[model samples]
Target: MAKMTHMKKQENQKSHFNHISHKEALVLTKIQQIKHQKSMDYWKQLVIAQQQSGFSVTEYCRQQDIKYNAFYYWLRKIREEALESLPQLPEKSTTNPQVAVLSATTVTAAVQTQSSSLKLFCGPVSLEVNEQTSNEMLMQTLRCIKEVFGIC
Candidate 1:
């Protein structure tokens, strides 16, 4: 794109920015893209901060001076983008997906029943999830887990 002739560049820039000269449109688009990226980064940081702060969304929004619904909107938007960025799984796979929700008591019983080098104990319930889980299932499971843990 940088190597193109000025006149030729103008000739090819007729997408949605026809209201302005091609050069101006290109500049405007770049600026808008940068702004959009910054906005995403800002909101993502806020979401991470709230998570680490151990504050509920309502409380976090109040402390941050942002509307409650607006925070949720951005959270949903960012989470969807993250899910989209993950690589797609194969339609048919030979491997089995291992997913389990185990209570502390259950884990203890399992440990007592067998002597193994591997063990997992979560005070609250715990889930063992892997990439083989469907994205929808993973998100839903995670939302449920968050609600259970009250971390979100």
Candidate 2:
């Protein structure tokens, strides 16, 4: 019983969160936001710079003295975050103005026309596109796959 009590006390102590004044908390939150924005801005600039330099990711990272994995990690994280902000389709409906249900026939048509370098594959579902594919088509295609196949 004594050992159990000691263990419980230790658990409670470890579970405790910092108690701070409301104003202090607000200040800390703002500071964190500023830091995050700063990092995002820096990375965003780097992304644009890489594109403008006409260098492959590996080459750009080498030229900029950035870790290749870190560059790719941040790039994917930033893209996922951006995609998250886009309006999502209803779970049970494809009637959303932004999302369209794609039949297997439609997918076949798309695949036939796709000879582009940009290809996205999720499980057995795949989408291929290039500069010509409108944002709406890409959004609808992705959402359709996500809704039907539980993928994104």
Candidate 3:
């Protein structure tokens, strides 16, 4: 009697697996794809918010009750997707551009004119630093600036 019951259960399981029609299977696949896309979008937004919060990844993950590994995995996956979606740039020519050299006097004059503040240019971003800024604070500020702008 137990063997017969086991056989019946196996048959029921087989029938359940075979119950879905082709259209139903396709609908199920589409639903799964939508769910996966939503999950990816959620994680991508979380990563962006964490980056803008000015907290380290470890600290952010800890505060958010997220696993560090999962956060990093999503971050890497988002970056990879972005990189893959970018259009490839054309190759540069072999010709080198002329280099302009500034004289010491010119550099000195420029420095003298900006004696009260130091200007740092990174790509299109510019930062003005007061003369009283400490070395450690300056380094930290530069790091924060790079993080904000994603500069190399």
lDDT of each: 0.68, 0.72, 0.73
The C-alpha stretches of model 3 lying farther than 4 A from their native spots are: 1-15, 88-152
lDDT of 1 by residue, 1-152 (tens): 36988877777775435567788878988999999777777787777678768889899889889999888888787767666654576686558877799999999978775553333234343555443457686666556444333333
Model 3, residue pairs in steric clash: none
Q: 48-135 in candidate 2: lDDT tens per residue?
A: 6786688999999998899999888777766665666556655775565576899999999787666544988776557777877779
TM-score of each: 0.49, 0.49, 0.47
Instruction: Give me candidate 2's TM-score against the actual structure.
Output: 0.49
Q: By summed lDDT, which 10 consecutive residues of candidate 2 come out lowest?
A: 143-152
Which candidate gets the maximum lDDT versus the true structure?
Answer: 3
Give the CA lDDT, 0 to 100, for residue 65 in model 1. Answer: 97
Among all windows of 10 consecutive residues in model 1, the one with the lowest summed lDDT is 116-125
